[model samples]
Target: MAAAAPALTRSRRPRLGALERRNLRWGLLFISPWLFGFLALSVFPILYTFFLSFTRYSGIRPPVIIGLTNYERIATDPLFWKSAYNTLFYTALAVPIGVLMAMILAVAMNQKLREVGIYRAILYLPSILPVFAISLIFIYLLNPAYGMVNALLGLAGLPSPNWLGDPTYARISLVLIAQLGAGQWALVFLAGLRGIPIELYESAEIDGAGAWTKFRRITLPLMTPVILYDIIIGLSLGLQVFTSAFILTGGGGGRGGGAGPDNALLTYVYYLYKQAFQFGQMGYAAALSVVLFVVSLVLAGAVFRWARGWVFYEAEDA
Candidate 1:
């Protein structure tokens, strides 16, 4: 029996080796593109940026060692504070509004209604629109004079503020514009909603649970992981808001740059860009990038930690 076992093992070794070699070849071939791209584009740039953060380098000149000077300067910079405040404020306002809008739309879409496919297409259309196009459209729409938004407000006898021009309304306008792109969030949430087992709903109904009760007890709890995912995405994107702010507020760079009326739309990325490109403070901008990276990491980590108590997983329950 022992002699036969050794013979069987020896016979299987060659077959296993051949199979493993074949799988290894295919796996390496499949992943070569991703590996190449990551090393060239992501890894090299990240390490280079870290090195640059400690040195002062303009595009025209070689980098000079300037240990912590940029960080010290940013420590006292009021513009940095203002931009941070604006970013956090935008995140605070936009995340909740976007998530709520997405959840509502997702719930509505989950209904067994006729022409559901058409409704989904119409609802998801905004998400597929080019961001530049959306920004341009909003700029035209928010034109206080002869704009569709103001024209509608006039018909409704409501006050129409200069959305992109006024300091108070500029930030609000950006938030509202962001909500127009909530179709992506809705789609994500809708997928999550569909993944919930119908049997759970049936069991809840059998227990005499009403719509609100089922949502609170079953739906909300089950959807916590999806909610966490959306919140992280929204917060990360919100903190790095640049394109819409830049295009909408006239893309410019200088000490006194295009930050809208009263610098209301002066986001962190915009400020960083101005520092790096306009003022020749590449080191400072790198420092700002580090700070933004750290803040995002910290916030995401906190969310993950907090989610432990609330984010339900069927595998964990099992």
Candidate 2:
């Protein structure tokens, strides 16, 4: 029985060959570099920044140990509130309008019509334009007197509001321009729209459905996933809007370069940029970044939650 027990054990348990074990180890080893890089670059930096947020550090010098002073200051800071308000305003305005416009353009581009390529090209060109250069062009276009926009307004006997210069219009100008250059988003929507099968639309048409009814029942429901995707992206980008605000609000290198007019166009990221690079308050900026991180996480989670009910993923069709 004892001799048979040893034979049974040997038969039941077979050790991996040295070469196979070596290959397994090497597989893990290959991924270890990526894991290490992710830890150092992605994870550690995030932790370090969160720690720094509680301290005070000018970019030129070492951090001074402080306990929640920056957070406390930000809690009561009017400029912080102003920036938050402007960011929220931008997010609110840009998300729905931009998404709707993008979807509209995408649907138009998806039609089997002549010159569709030209239409698509023209629509997407603005997205690739240098943002700063686009802002410069818009600056001249929105100029009070000599601008073409105002000139058209004058010809129509309408009042021309100063776009970048006026407090009332400053934030709206950013929102408007963001909407205007939604070409990239349009392309994304176009891709999603094209992915929808023609059979469903044909079936709806065969059922004697009207154009509006067919769209409402087939197009919109199936497109909900893409719509939700656009919402998440638009919210995140709009909340962090910087380039348009930076150009309109006088660049972020000095205190004078705060938001335009009454700080109407100041976004969360623009404020954070001003704090870190311009004011050299790296700690406060880190704290702001942390806040932004939390807010973004929350927003993303909310979108996912809402999408669970609203969005019709491809898997749902199966």
Candidate 3:
């Protein structure tokens, strides 16, 4: 009976007509350029990199098959460990802080003030600015001698440290740099905030809930999905932190160049860049890239798994 039912359902399904087939062909033709670009530019490079990770290639010479040597080298590489630690530490600090700042901005922007539009524009402006330009600005702002940061510290009689020059503060400085793009995530958070039903807040208020209570009980739960998204995105970007570090550390140049003092700013991607371009260890670099890809996938998967416990869907409740 079940088999007959399946067959009946399949038989009832309409077949594509000549006109439908022609439309499908036209649709495929329209998207062929993007399809080719994705295959040629994105998919092919990723597959090639994976293949190269298993071989010894110095770019000029033909690649030689060397199974796991690069990965083995990475296992024992002190710089690899250092870069990994730095990347993780940066992500751990930056993601949470960025998320918090973004949420704050979103809440503030969600207010019913007449100038809210102007305020939002002003706040989001920094997120759109080029990272290179922002890094350059930070270079001057964090200058220990005469920078604005130090000048402000001096006014408050606080100690001023060489933000980029000192290893102890270099990573911290980069974490601070990561906050500049919080406005981008703030926009995502704003959308989530807007999507929350106003009725919930009204009901909370009628139940004698204050702002904090309403936020904690109503806003927070509803916003978990957006928060999860921001965290995943923040983690991905933070793990690949390179531009600001590279720029702040003078393009990783000088005596122990490419890594800031005591290798404080030696992010994983920066180290990979150094190996692939600066040192010409293409095979090792490819291996590093593969590891990063795996790590990113694992982290994203873990976040999604964790989110299942807390992420709320209005449709699910409905």
| Candidate 2 local Cα displacement, residue 314, angstroms | 2.9
* Consecutive 10-residue window with the lowest summed lDDT within model 3: 1-10
Q: Give the deviation of candidate 2 from the true structure as CA RMSD.
A: 6.2
**CA deviation > 4 Å runs, candidate 3:** 1-15, 254-258, 316-318
Q: What digit string (tens of lDDT, one per residue) describes model 3 on residues 31-94?
A: 9999999999989999999999999999999999899999999999988998999999999999
Q: Candidates ranked by lDDT, best first?
A: 3, 1, 2
lDDT of each: 0.86, 0.83, 0.89
> What are the per-model numbers of colliding residue pairs?
0, 0, 1
Q: What is the C-alpha RMSD, rounded to one decimal, of candidate 3?
A: 3.9
Candidate 2 local lDDT, 1-318, one digit each (tens):
223222233556666667758978999899998989999988998998999999999977888879899899889978888899989988898899998899889988888889988888888998888777777777788888888888998899999998777876888878878876788889988898888889988988888999889778878888888899889888888777888888865574336536777888777888898888887889999999888889999989998997898787666542
Q: Whole-model lDDT for model 2 versus the true structure?
A: 0.83
Q: What is residue 176's positional error in candidate 1, in angstroms?
A: 0.9
Backbone clashes in model 3, listed as residue pairs: 252-258
Strongest candidate by lDDT = 3
TM-score of each: 0.89, 0.87, 0.91
